[model samples]
Target: MRKNSIKNTRVNVEVQHELANLIREGIKDPRIHPMTSVTAVEVAPDLKTCRAYISVMGNEEAKNNTIVGLKSAEGYIRRQLAKNINLRNTPEIRFILDESIEYGVAMSKLIDEVTGKEEVQEDGENNQ
Candidate 1:
């Protein structure tokens, strides 16, 4: 099957959703932060491998620990995945730390700072 085919897209979405659910409620590892989220999932067309992008809302240590926890739980996650979703072959999950959400938040803060400074300047000028 083609990588971007409809079937592949559906598989990706389903895997992503199930992964998020599993991480949020199935796992009991303390290393995995409660603020963790599955940002995206990419399953190979052959359904032999998968990349799960995970985002954690905390320090570097928390992110690292979350990945480690997820990696250790791969087998269990896969089994759960197979039971939950009827796929031809349950993909082997590779946990990847995704910093896009953090980056976006930082960028937003910078923008707000810049805009706030401009607003302050405008207000000061108006008061003169």
Candidate 2:
């Protein structure tokens, strides 16, 4: 199958949904933060491997610990995926720490600061 086939897209979405559920409810590890979420899932066309991007809403320590916990529980997660989805081969999940969300938030804050300063300067010029 092609890399960007319709079937592949469906598989990616299904895997992402299942992974989010598994991480949120199936795993009992304390290191996995409650605010953790599956940001994206990319399944190989051959279905031999998968990359699961995870986002954690916490400190650096929490993000690191969450990735470690997920990596340790990969086997169980793969087994669960096999049982839940009728895929030809259960992909080996590689947990990836995604900082895109945090980066976006930081960028937003910077924009606001810049805009705020511009507005203040405009007001000062008008007053002068």
Candidate 3:
């Protein structure tokens, strides 16, 4: 299949959704935080490997632990996924920590602070 074919896109989306559900309800590992979520999924064209992007809402330690826990449970998760979805081959799943959300939030806060300062300066000038 072509790398960017419609079939590949559909498979990627399906895998992402199923993986998120499995992590959310199937896995009971304590290391995986409740705030964990599947942010994205990239599957190889041959369906041999998949990179699952996960986001955790907590400190660095929690995020590391969540990735570790997911790595340990990769096999089981793949098996469950295969059973749920009729895929010819179950891809080797790799969990990755995604910090885009955190980065976006930080950027937004910085913008707000800058805009707030500009507003304050304008108010002062108006009052002067």
Candidate 4:
């Protein structure tokens, strides 16, 4: 079996990083919550549209508010992105809540709890 390289994935990652930084330092939307971070960017093969995944580290209200804020400023963001990225056509912006990072943290906690169980004395030899 051959190990495949994730060239496209790497490209997407780079784009995500740049986009995240751009959003953090460039746009200052009043609706945007203070704790928002761009988590991922999914660009289509044609690169016509890019889904920007955002993560907000706050309560449900804060999360919803941040997304609403971003949605309202889509046009401004698209323009800013166009100024930054050189492309034939600027990709349409779509803001999506990325819960994967939050989910991963939760999963890690659960896994730790489960693995800690293994340290307990089940029988005696099994504990070792």
For model 2, residues 1-128, the per-residue Cα lDDT tens digits are 44488999999999999999999899999989999999999999999999999999999999999999999999999999999999999999999999999999999999999999999999999999
| Clash total of candidate 1 | 0
Top candidate by lDDT:
2
Candidate 1 matches the true fold with a TM-score of 0.93
- Write candidate 1's Cα lDDT for 1-128 as tens digits: 44488999999999999999999999999999999999999999999999999999999999899999999999999999999999999999999999998899999999999999999999999999
Worst 10 residues of 2 by lDDT: 1-10
Instruction: Please give the lDDT score for candidate 4.
Output: 0.77
Pairs with steric clashes in candidate 2: none
**Candidate order by lDDT, highest to lowest?**
2, 1, 3, 4
Question: Mind giving the per-residue lDDT tens digits that candidate 4 earns over 96-116?
Answer: 998888899999999999877
Whose lDDT is higher: candidate 1's or candidate 4's? Answer: 1
Q: Candidate 3: minimum summed lDDT over ten consecutive residues — where?
A: 1-10
